[model samples]
Target: MPSPLPSRASAAGPVPGRYDRFLILGAVCLAGLVLPLSFTAPPVAIPAIAAELGGSPVALNWMTNAFMLAFGSCLMAAGTLADTYGRKRVFSIGIVAYAIVSLLLALAPSLAVLNGLRIAQGVAAALALAGGNAALSQEFHGPARIRAFSLLGTAFGLGLAFGPSLAGWLVQTQGWRSVFLSSLAIALLATVFGVPRMRESRDPDAAGLDWRGSLSSTAMLALLTIGVLEAPERGWSDGWVIAALIGSAALLALFVRVETRAARPMLDLSLLKYPRFVGAQLLPIGTGFCYLALIIVLPVRLIGIHGLSALNAGLMMIALSAPMLVVPFLAAVLSHRIAAGTLCAAALLLAAAGLVWLGVEAAAGSVHGLIAPMLLIGAGSAVPWGLMDGLAISVVPKERAGMAAGVFGASRVSGEGIALAITAAALAGLLQLRLSSAIGVDGATLTQAAQRLATGDAARAQALLPQLDAAALVHSYDAAFAWLMYGLAGLTAAIAGVVFALLGDASAHEPAALAEPARDDRIELADEPAC
Candidate 1:
């Protein structure tokens, strides 16, 4: 009664017709790259884009956050939909939509339109990514699956690491619009290549989609992200900010309640019952914080403070990303010998060391001092990025792999969104403090000015603006970096603790089992009820 095993030709194994399997994998991975490429494009062209668009600094922040908010919040829903529909079908649709949205983005004449298109792009990306692991798992079994998964991880890392570089090249050669054009082309190609060969995977008897859970979770995430992203511009105590936080908490509570009661929950709440699952989820949260903070803050510090060109800053960032390129393969190899927890711990230590070194060195104005540390951070980050997917999936039943994968992806993205918000708040607070000190403005004066500005007292900010000096601005920036160092140090310590306590030593555990005994032809694609 174990649903009659799939036919040998369809089952995941070393079959003669497996060439098509590789093609499917390649198509999915290529589709996966589109989102990262889109997300990273603006950072490379922020200065130019802002100059042409005539937007304030905050607009730059929204450019990325808007996409992340939509993408992260909808991930679970996309996965659920994939499970209800067919993986191949959903993936093809997503690729087509993403391609169309990319074209729209390329033609957008205003920032608002571009951001709107980005949100649509995020939704499309969610759909494309939701079924990725399920499809990979179905195509390759045991050792083959491990390799494919490792490659999937590598693709993700490469997307982030290479996106800016690619964007930079496009911006330099054909202008900012070229980035979107390139993305559209890739998406189109993915659709063309994917639709023909990709096999469908859907559980015919899968539980109904949990619409209530999905809606509540989405509401919670959106409200929370909005609140956090807005706190820097609006004081923490602002009514709208407070309302968002309150609403987020209420919605999250509702989501938890609904999921607990739902027969078919969007998120499988029971997964957290396993210690390994909890650890796997938390590690990515920490990793997200480390990864995004470094990605966002490092370039700003380099270009804004060190007076480096965007190209030079980008190259320097490579030091932080290069190890990532190699880590996935290494982690895949190491997984055969070591416990993932142990490797994750070691990676965290390396990341912490790098962060600390970077913070101290940057505060001291020594770019050279940051290089070695960044190398360590890059190496450390590689371990988690490579292994976390395996760990997340391993903790769950094979039948729930699709849901587990969705949770893993959603958690990482959510962590990134939260990290950006927190880092932004920290940066804004640091800037304000530095600005106040440098300008010799008392807290009372600044508060009064800010209050007036909040009430449409543009004249007050205008009056205060003339008194701000260049040296003071520089001093403020210096102070902001100084404060940010404290945050970096704290994060390093937290990551180190989590890795050491939860992960332990790599040599302590046996490798996960690889091959299942079914014959090659008996392999059928895994059922993805919640892609």
Candidate 2:
């Protein structure tokens, strides 16, 4: 039988109390903050940047996509590096690199320079983010681990939920350059505090870095991301799009084959053999789709259809995010008594109900109608997001914690990217059909108009004005929201079914598998007496 999980008091080791872990948590979370800040800051400053840089809407899209693509692709590589080298060393290096890149971004003279810096920043972010969960897994265990993990989830949630609003305000109060400078300062501080206090954690017995696996994975992700981003602008049938799809599939197939045969694989294919692990990984994929879809769809609906300013629209979306803060804590408390899978299923149901209410509200054309639904969705999402990491990592051995952490993080990021692509396709297709029918124009003409409008080419859109009407545009938006609602509902039902069917009893796994160890290996090494 496996041993029971260590309590919070024991998990802290010689640090004195549970509160001591907060400093380390803050340092780890600081690294994570950069990612959301970078992803969000550009949207607020896009118009100004375009005015100065003379780039089209596609150029601006690349600014964000480039970072996300690089960051997502590099995560597996970073994880391997952390496991082979020391986590603290890699994390600190990443922090320093991220800060330097942010400064470079602030001083970038042209769009090309900025795009290059964004990719560098993403590389740094991938290194830092890939090891965060492993650090926590090594440092804390049992109920303490649960609480610490919850706080980590809260930090990420707050970053996504509030990063854009903060960036918007910064752009308004200070220049766009201030955003990068501010993040740079935060990264520097994290490095300063983290270097002396943070201890290294990596299993010396782990396999060497999987270069082949990393390369194949990165190539696959880049091809896939580029294909999705381009598909909306280029026809799905375009040669370039088709080529990207084929290349991505081939690379991914190669990656799977490589992992299966590698002496020390980057991804442990055996994890999927367990039902709970599979369910845990899949739940995040589904939830990520719903979470990002609602986030993107709701804001666009509010700003474009209702004529609300960006700031106001972002604030309104807070109705959906505010409850996320509380639900995780509640879920943590509930997890002591109920199964993690059961809580996840319940959360999905609540989120689905919220989505349904949101659809009803949108169909009726009342902005105020969305508030309640947003709250429900927010509350529901909190628990599952908080619990997902724990669920995945719990099933693995302590020695393989870094591998588990790497895989879990990769799954969530990949899921978010795939979700974004799927949601974008659905919304774009629906918008085209509805607008074309309403405006009495062919689909091709309507798509051109929509593209012009999306790119902020008001003059061009006005010149083509006779081809489309205001009512038609509004109808197009309404149709997109309708599709989003249906997607969310279907996603929620699927999540519920998976949870109930696959994860009905959490106790099927050895209790020792669920419990934290007596001593944190990371802390033990850090506190060892010098020879």
Candidate 3:
């Protein structure tokens, strides 16, 4: 297993003598970069978008989660379609759809319309991500694949790092609408390059479709997401919340049954048997829950609570995002020399420690206190983000590349949305508990107050609950934050241990021999235990 090290390659690690892989990598990276832009940029513009479009607090939450939930729900189905049809075809279609949606975003007359389009954008995003990652995993081999994934990580990091800063500038210069246009420009650009440059690839043996599996998977994700998002507004005991939860469970069972019986399941259930692959998936879920939660929440905290302008609020995050931009390149360099598990575990430990520190200071509403913690968390997170992705995709053979990438992407995006929802719900419940004791507000009023605080709408919170002492409100916010940060920190730290213990050896994940398309007709791929 060690003899065919990634450093020693099948023709210098796939795409042997040609630079065509670089072009493909660039196209994919371009698409990957746009996602963080869409995610982070909107947070800065939310207040503006809400004001112009006249949305309720719930509408605002949907503005963000709608995209994520739709994307997450459709990812597996999109992967199957990619495998059955063609990666390039799907990728190009996604780019075009994304561009069209982004353009429509600027023209939407109401938040409801914008939210609907965002869901469409999410679907397009799923297609692009599945196709892009599958293409990279299939074409790049050995160290080159590692480098390719790392580069993709770097692109993602760059998007995360710069998105807020750019959005703040754009929102200040142009209208809030410019943020959508900015994203549109990128998508249109990706389409131009992707159409001609991308190589078409598909699984020749793929069955048509798993209709029941796809339908059930979508219902499961959508219902679970709906339940979590509503938990903050309506009590967990609310009839609809309870029904959504039950329906989600039932649908998940049905999805499992269908997948197990299908000739070609949307996802390979057998992949779950590998501890390393599951562990790799946990990376995205934990990261989505923790780091991204921080990104989404912190800017709002800085802007609304600390009285910083959006520009300054974003600038403060430079400590976090800046490290992310450079860390992936370093990770790519060290991948050959270090064990992936050891490196990722060690880095996450650093991140967890940082999160704990950040939580304590963040609760007190101190922007200055967050800088060091942000740097620590950023450094820890960037190293492993791409590596974990490589781990997930590497464990599956090229034929199932779309499925593997879809799984990885789903974990990350769904985890982010779910984690944020949970964090917001927990914060709201705790904040209300604290406030009820201190301020004596009724349950319904407190629910609204908590929702406002969760969304970083300090202005709306003050306007609604003017009788509450300002000092008491801040204290309650901090108290809720304290619980969230510490819990997430401990959880993240624990997962670090799992990484070391679970991902024992990655040589087992080496790619099966891939036939050079131009040179050989011989192709050998196993359907199971590729890891």
> Candidate 2: global Cα-lDDT?
0.71
Output the number of the lDDT-best candidate: 3
Global lDDT of each model? 0.69, 0.71, 0.76
RMSD of every prediction? 5.6, 4.1, 5.2
What candidate 1 gets wrong by more than 4 Å, as runs, is 1-18, 46-61, 430-441, 444-483, 499-531
Candidate 3 lDDT over residue span 153-208, tens digit each? 77876787788788888988998999999999988777776556555666766778
Each candidate's TM vs. the true structure?
A: 0.84, 0.89, 0.87
Error of 2 at 51 (Å): 2.8
Q: Which pairs of residues clash in candidate 2, taking residues 3 or more apart in a chain or in different chains?
A: 2-512, 5-515, 5-516
Which candidate wins on TM-score? 2
- Compute the lDDT of residue 79 as modeled in candidate 3: 84
Residue by residue across 1-531, what tens digits does model 2's lDDT show?
A: 355443222222254244546667777767666667777667778776787776777788888888887887777778777777766667777788899999998898888889888999988888777666666666666777776676667667777777778888887888788889988988887776655566566665566788899899888877877787677678688899899989999998999999999988877777666677677777676676557667766776777666778878887889988976788778878888887788888888888888887877877777878888888888888877777766666666555556666666667777777776667666666666666676666756567766554433334544675755565556556655666687767877787788767765552112224324453332223432111
Displacement of residue 503 (Cα, Å) in model 2 is 4.1
After aligning candidate 3 to the native by TM-score, how far in Å is the CA of 135 from where it should be?
Answer: 0.7
Kindly indicate the candidate among 1 and 2 with the higher TM-score: 2
Better of 2 and 3 by TM-score: 2
